[model samples]
Each structure stands twice: as C-alpha cells, then as structure tokens.
Target: MRITKVKYKDALIQALLFIYLIFTVYPVFLMVITALKTNAEIIKHPLSMPIKLNFSGFIKIFTTQNFALYFRNSFFVTVLSILITVFVSILLSYALARYKMKYVNPLSIYFLAGMMIPIRLGVLYINELLNTLNLIDSLIGLILVYTAMTIPFSMFIFMGFIKMVPVELDESAYIDGCSERKILFRIIAPLIKPAVATVTIYNFVPIWNDVYFPLIFIHSPEKKTLLLAVTIFFGQFQTDWSLVFSALTVATIPVLTIYLVGSKYFIRGLTSGALKG
Candidate 1:
C-alpha cells in the first residue's frame, strides 16, 4: 500500500511539471512560428502555423536595417562587461574570503548595500560621470556602466564559492613558496569554475537585453545595442508584427545559446556549495 501511494504522488508531481513546462515554452513556440508568417497572415490568424515559411523579416533586418551592427555592439558590451566584472569581483571576493583584515566586514557590507538598492536609481549620476569621462555616446561608456552594475552581485557569488574553499590550501601553497598571485590564480582559481560560469551567465542576460541604459546613453545609430536598435520597427500608426517577431527571435538566440552552453555549470554551481570537502 505504501509503495502504491508513493507511485501515485510521483506521477502527480511529474504531471504538474509537464504542464508548467508547456506553459513556459508555449510563448516562445508561438513567437518562432509567428516570425515565419507574413504580417497579413499574423493579423488574420495570430496563432496558426504559417502557410509557407517566410524568411523576409530575418533577411530584411540583416540586409537593410543594419541589424548586424546591433548584434556586434551587444556582443562587445556583454563580453567586456562580464570580463571586467569577473576579474574585479573574483579578486575582491578572494580577499574577503581569505583575509582577516579590520575592514573586511565593512567592505562586505558595502557590496551588500549596493545589492540591496537598484542600480537604475542612480542613472543620473552614472550619466554625469560618463559625460565627465567623455564616454557618453560610446560603447566603452556602456561597458563601464554594465561592469559597475553587475560587480556587486558577482562579488557576492564569488565570496560564497571562495569561502567554501578551505583556507588550508592557501597555507599549504604559501609554505611551498607560491606567491599570493600564484595561490589565487593557480591554486584557488581552478577550484571555482562553477562560480565563474554562474557569474558569467547571470550577468550576461541583463547586459545583453538592457534597453534602458542604451536608450539614455547612446544617441548614435552605430552604437545602439540589439534591443535598442529593434525599436525602429515600431510606428505610431502601425507596427511591423513580422519584423518585430523576427528581431525578437534573433535577439533571443544568443541568450539561449549562452545559457545552454553554460547550463551544466550553472546548475552545478547552484547545487554545489563552493569547494566544500
């Protein structure tokens, strides 16, 4: 009787999960199909499959609308931002995790405070700072903003992982004459791959999809990111449904690809606790 009861409960849980999966994926499934339909077909049958696949939206955006530029800009910003954030965060987190300094707790609280407040709340200050630095309307300016915005969260992740790693390893390396840099880069760094992957994917999504920062800071058409550049398809009187869907689909591909590539590390990172013995 207990075995039968357990089987029934398992079956119920599986059924609920399957339903949730469908609910999650249904919208993306709709968008891809709609991207293949013409505007007329979409207006007539919003959810119906296309009579014939139309690649015009994809082609036109790439050929005439300078979509490649947006893709390149977003790619450059996201990659550079992640690199800077990770480099700064890992080192800071290593200090916080390994050192017993007087100001360590205070420094942790500072990053915690940053995490508590939304970074967007200080956009005006960021803009002024960027302008003072003469990085306004520049990709480098955008990269700096994204880097600053993500550092606190990335530091938090790194701190957790670095803390889980036993300090005895550091002591052993030090006794063996490994320099501080060598201890960090050669000893501790290899053990924290999961944390690196987690930070990369977590920061990648927001920086890639962000339109608010680009809309405010970037004025030149050449510097606009993918989400910002896609806005041209919208009009006051009529919107291009097909093109919008196509642009959205194109914008979504890199995000999904990154997530898929790092998904194993991401999952393991979340489930595993630092470098616990």
Candidate 2:
C-alpha cells in the first residue's frame, strides 16, 4: 500500500510537471513551426505540421539585412562587457570580503544603489556624456553602458560568494609569503569560481537581450546589434510574421547556447554549494 501510494503521487507530480513544461515551451515551438512553414500553410493549418520546409524567410533576412553586422556587434559588446564585469567584480569583491576597512560596507552599499537604479532613468545624462566623448551610437558606447549597468549586481553576488569561502585559505596563502594578488588569483578566486559562473549567466543573457540601450546608443547601420536586427526584419517585410519568426528563432540561438553552457555553474552558485567541504 505504501509503495502504491508513492507511485501514484509521483505519477501525479510528473503529469503536472509535463503540463507546465508544455505550457511554457509550446509558444516557441509554435513559432519555430511557423518559421519553418509557408504563410499559406500557417494560415490554413495553424498548428499542423509543415507540408514542406521553407528557408526563404531566413535567407531573405540575411541577404537583405545587416544581420551579420548586428550579430558581430552584439557578440563583441557582450563578450567585452562580461570580461570587464567579471574582472572588476571578482577583485573588488575579494577586497571587501578579505580586508576589513572603515568604508567597505558603505562602498558596497553604493554599488547596491547603482544596482537598484534603472540605467534608462539616466538616459539623458548618459547620452550627453557619451556625446562629449564622441562615443554616441558606437559599440564602445554600448559596452560602457552595459558594464556600468551590470557591475553592482555582479559585485553583490561575488561579495556573498567570497564571504562563503573560508578566510583560512587567504591566511594560509599569506603565511606562505604569497602577495595579495597571488592570494586573490591562486587561492581565493579558484575557491569562489562557481559564483562567477552564476553572475555571468544572469548578466550575459540580459545584456544580449537588451533593446533599450542598443536602440538609444547604437544608431549607425554598421554598428546595429542583434536585437536591432530583429527590428529590421519587422520593417522590410512590412511586418511579415513568417520572417519575423525566423529572425527571432535564429537570434535566440546564442543566448540559449550560453545558458545551456553556464546553467550548471549558475545552479551551483545560486545554491552556494561550491563553498561546502
């Protein structure tokens, strides 16, 4: 009776889980289905399987649009932004975690403030500042904004993770005559690596998906990023739903790939499991 009850409960839970998964995933599944079908088939059979596969929407998108440029630009900005955010955040977090100082907490609170404040609220000022630096509508302009926007949260995550690590590791390194930098890289950083993966996955996806900053800061045809590429698909086809679906499905590949690769570390970091024995 006990085993039978357990089996029944497990079956019910699995059924619910499958329903939720389908509910979440079906829209994208439908969109991909649409992208692969002709407009006639989509209109006639909405959810039915495609009669024949179509790559025309995708072909038109690449050939008629500056999609390649957008992919390159977004790739460059996101990659550079992630590298900078991680480097600055980890070292700064180490200092706050390992060294006691009068202002460390206050400085951390400052980052918290920045995190809470929306970057778009400062749009006017940021645009003006970038103008003075001649960086407006440039990839550099996008990178600057992305870095500033993500720093606070990244710092916060790193701080919590570094705290979770034992200070004994730092002390042991110091006893061996290792310098501060050496202690950070060789001992502390290696210990707290999981949290870094967590922060990266969280920040990287948003940075890649952001439409507002790129819309505001990147204007030149040569410099438009991927989200902006999705916009072009909207215009040239006069809102062709088929092409829009194709472009969107294609654009989602990178973000999904990144999440799949980083998700394991992200889970570890969120659970703070890396700090355990």
Candidate 3:
C-alpha cells in the first residue's frame, strides 16, 4: 500500500510538470501559428490553426527592416557583456574567497546592492553620464551598461562556488613558493567552472531580450538591438500581426538555442558546485 501511494505521488508530480510544460509552450505555439497565418485569419480565430502557410511576413521583415543591424548589435553587446562579467566576477570572487580583508563582507554587499535596484531607476543620471561621454546610440554604451548591470549576480554565483574551495590548497601552493597572484591564476581558479557557466547563462538571456533600455537609450537607426528591431513590424495605422509574430520568432530562436546548449553545462556546474558536500 505504501509503495502504491509513492507511485501515485510520483505520477501526480509528473502530471503537474507536464501541465506546466504545456502552459509554458502554449504561447510559443500560438506565436508560431499566428506567424504562419494571414492577419485576417488571425483576427477571425486567434487560437485556431493557420489556414495557409504565410511567407510574406518573413520576406517583408528581412527585406524592409534593419534586422541585420539589430542582430549585430545584440550579438556584439551580449558577447562583450559575457567577457566583462566573467572576468570581473571571477577576479572579485577569488579575492573575497581567499583574502583576509577588513569589510570584505560589507564590500560584497555593496557590489550586490546593484542587483536589488533597477538601473532604469537611475535613467536620469545614466542619461547624463551617457550624454557627457557621448555614448548615445552606440553599441559600446549598451555593452557597458549590460556588463555593469550583470556583474552583481555573476559575482554572487562565483562567490558561492569560491567559498566551497578549501583554503588548504591555496596555503599549500604558497608554501611551494607560489606568489599570491600565481596561486590565484593557477591553483584555485579552475574548480568554479560550473558556477561560471551558471552565471553566464543567467546573465546572457536577459541582456539579449532587453528592449526598454535599447528603445530609450538608442535613437540611431543603425544601433537597434534585436528586441527593438521587432518594433518595426508594428505600425501606427496598421499592425501586421503575422509579421510581428514572425519577427518575434526570428528574434527568439537564437536566445533559445543558446539556452538549450548552455543549460546542460549550467545545471551540471550548479549541482557539482553546491551538492559536493
């Protein structure tokens, strides 16, 4: 009877998970179906299957919109943000983990405070800073903003992994005449790969998908990101539902592909980093 109850509970959990997956995928299914339908067909039955496959929306966006430029900007910014965040987080985590410094904990809290507050809250200040630096509508400006914004979370994840490493390793290396910098770069830096993967995946997605900052901060036609580029599919007089869906479909595929490729590494890293004890 107890075994039967356990089976039933497991079945219940599986059913719930399946339902959640469907709920998550329903929007994607809707978007794909709408993208395949004519705007009139979409209006008639918003949830119904497409009567005919539509390719004009796809053609219109690629031919008419600044899709290529937007794609380039987003790709450049996300990659650069990854580089900056990883470098800074790894170095900062190493110091906090190994060094005996006064105010180390408080200092970490100070770095982490940025995570709680939205950077948009300081738009006035950011605008002034950007204007003074003459960074308006520049991809470099976007990259810097995303890198600085993503650092807190990356630092936190790296710090968690670094804490799990034993100090004895560092001490042994020091005894062998390794300098402080040498020990940091060579001895204790490798065990945190999983945390690094987790941090990268976590930070990359939001940066890729962010639209508000790109819209407000960028005005130049050439500097649009993928999310902002999708806005071109919408018009004041007439919104092309099918084209909008198609643009979203185009924009979403790359991020989803990255997540799928990275999730395996990210989860493996998290489990190894946290459950090793």
**lDDT of candidates 1 onward, in order:** 0.87, 0.83, 0.82
The parts of candidate 1 lying over 4 Å away from their true place are: 1-13, 235-238, 264-277
lDDT for model 2, on a 0 to 1 scale?
0.83
- The TM-score obtained by model 1 is 0.89
Structure candidate 1, residue pairs in collision? none
Worst 10 residues of 3 by lDDT: 268-277
Clashing pairs in 2: none
Model 3 C-alpha lDDT versus the unseen true structure: 0.82
**For model 2, how does the per-residue alpha-carbon lDDT over 1-277 read when each residue is reduced to its tens digit?**
9999999999999999999999999997998888888877877898997788998888877888667778888899999998999999898888888778998989887877886578899999999999999999899888989998888878878898889888887788789999989988887788777777788887888899998987887878888889886876567665476788888888898988987888886565445523322
TM-score of each: 0.89, 0.89, 0.85
How do the residues 1-277 of candidate 3 rate in per-residue lDDT, one tens digit apiece? 9999999999999999999999999999998898899989989999999877988777877888767777888889999989898998889888887778997988888987886788888878887888899997788888888988988777877887888888898889889999987887786667777777788777778899998788888998888888887775454214688888888898999888878899886565455434534
lDDT of 1 by residue, 111-218 (tens): 867766788999999999999999999999999889888888788889988999999999999999999999999988899987888889878888998989998999
Question: Which run of 10 residues does model 2 get worst, by summed lDDT?
Answer: 268-277
Error of 1 at 8 (Å): 5.7
Error of 3 at 206 (Å): 1.2
18 Cα displacement, candidate 3 (Å): 3.8
Model 2 ranges with Cα > 4 A deviation: 1-6, 266-277
Full candidate order by lDDT, most accurate first: 1, 2, 3
Query: Which is the leading candidate under lDDT?
Result: 1
